[model samples]
Target: MKIKSFEIFDYESAVTFWKSIEGVTLNESDTKGSISSFLFRNPGLSFVAKDNNEIVGTILCGHNGRAAQIYHLAVSNSHRGQGLGKELVDLSLSKLVEANIPRCNIFVYSNNCVGNKFWLKNGWDDPTTWKVLQKQLDV
Candidate 1:
């Protein structure tokens, strides 16, 4: 398997892979145009793992001038248990470090047992003192 920078060309396969995962939710922000803009803005931060020219994993990472955020980290079921997820994360974090970003965060649904377990086992903490709130704005 080889890891490569994510481009808009990779979107279709990446989205398909994401949709196949149980915990990943697709929304307006994940549209092709939005993801294209994101990749343009963040550049080298996102990545895809391709094996034999097929997308097997992906990580979408970006920073808002302060802290970095990771989204849509998914690996093909066949590729799990091979540390591909960690490799993708480590690569993103390394880029963030190079850019001087201080911290990184990810959102995992409370009901996503598999995802929650992965994050916990990987040393990600759910801060008891903080809660995430959101409001969808009409465009």
Candidate 2:
């Protein structure tokens, strides 16, 4: 298994991996193209983990050169419990550090027990630094 940054070639594999989630309600499959386009226009900021030529996990890292946001972490079902998710996170941070990014953050839904536990176990804590505000956009 090898963990590597995102490539234009990995888009289809990434989509397949994402589409397998049966429990979560994500946007329909139509967004795959937009997602790939976003990453293609902004490289070195996201990653895809593959094993035996299949995408097993993915991570999206946002950038400002000072801090980065880790989001959209997804690991294929069969690949769970193999540390691929953690490896994806580590690789993103490693790349950010190499580029001189000083801080990073990831926002997981508070109700997601496993995600909360994972972040806690990984030493993610910065309550005062994050704020949640929203506006109702007229539809």
Candidate 3:
């Protein structure tokens, strides 16, 4: 398996891989055009893992001026136990560090047991004092 930067050409395979995973949620922001714009805004932070040229894992990472956010981290079921997820995360975090981002955040659904477990086990702290609130704006 080889890990590499995520190019727009990798979108289809990455989306397919993400759709096959249980805990990942896809939304309007996930469209190819949106992703392309995201890549443009924050280059070299997102990545994919491939096995024999087939995309097996992905992580979409970006940052606002203040903090980094990670999204859509998924690995094929067959590739789950091999540390691909952690590797993807580490790569993104390293990029953030280089960019001088002070903190990183990821959103996992409260009900996504596997995802929550993975994050916790990987030393990500879940702070009880904060709640994520959102409002969908009509674009």
TM-scores of the candidates are: 0.97, 0.76, 0.97
- RMSD (CA, angstroms), candidate 1: 0.7
In terms of TM-score, how similar is model 3 to the real structure? Answer: 0.97
Which candidate do you rate higher for lDDT, 1 or 3?
Answer: 1
Error of 3 at 55 (Å): 1.0
For each candidate in the order shown, give its overall lDDT on alpha carbons.
0.93, 0.73, 0.93
Model 1: per-residue Cα lDDT over 12-58, one tens digit each: 98888899988999998999999999999999999999999999999
- Which of 1 and 2 is the better model by TM-score? 1
Write out the backbone clash pairs for model 3: none
Q: Which 10 successive residues of model 2 have the least lDDT summed?
A: 21-30
Off by over 4 Å in 2: 22-37, 40-42, 126-129, 135-139
In model 2, pairs of residues that clash are none
- Give per-residue CA lDDT, model 2, range 63-97, as digits (tens): 76677887668887788777787888888888788
Q: What is the lDDT of candidate 1?
A: 0.93
* Pairs of colliding residues, candidate 1: none
| Model 3, total clashes | 0
RMSD versus native structure for model 2: 3.3
